[model samples]
Target: MAIGTLDAAAAYGRSLKTLAPAIGESTAATEQHAGGGNSFGSMIETMVSDAAGSLRTAEAESAKQVAGKGDMIDVVTAIGAAETALDTVVAVRDRVVSAYSEIMRMQI
Candidate 1:
């Protein structure tokens, strides 16, 4: 891959690692607030939404750079990260939906 792409991936990885603890804490707090009745499906949905938001922000930054309003490397990196993040979110959504369908199809 290109250097910009690699850099973006690294940055995205770091960002996820840094944010994970906070996300987990918030998720836990949300579950506690709901008296522990929060479903895994809802938690996954929330995470996917968060990923989508991050991707949107990255795409905006990338667009600004492409318009000559920002750094080229930074812009390229951000775009790559955004695309990857969005793809991941989409994949997770697909998996979750599939799992839900399967559960519904059970004979129980």
Candidate 2:
């Protein structure tokens, strides 16, 4: 299915909302919270790690549900969070790739 611009915008807003708490924080604050060095690579690494964690949580929830030990609501929520995190990671990756491609095509 074709995704409309509005849908894309809404998805971007949702992703931003998920990360709103960290958006305006200082680099030092972010580094402290993230428990790592202050750099773009480190920030991306943190994001990817968090996304992986979310996906793992979702998988665990699904397994629990399959084994009849998890609440349906919890499973659904975890899955939703995982989906959002994955979307955010994919969006960032896409932007990075696009920027790289643009740079490669630029005249020196």
Best by lDDT: 2
Q: Tell me the alpha-carbon RMSD of every candidate.
A: 12.4, 11.8
lDDT of 1 at 85: 71
Per-candidate TM vs. native?
A: 0.51, 0.67
Candidate 1 local lDDT, 2-56, one digit each (tens): 5533344345444544564666767665544334246553444455556666777
Clashing pairs in 2: none
Residue-wise C-alpha lDDT for candidate 2, range 1-108, written one tens digit per residue:
997433454455445434636578666555453464565545666677787789899999999999999999999999999999988878887898799999999999
Give stretches of model 1 more than 4 Å off.
Answer: 1-42
lDDT of each: 0.62, 0.74
User: Candidate 1: what lDDT?
Assistant: 0.62
Candidate that scores best on TM-score: 2
User: Stretches of candidate 2 above 4 Å error?
Assistant: 1-35
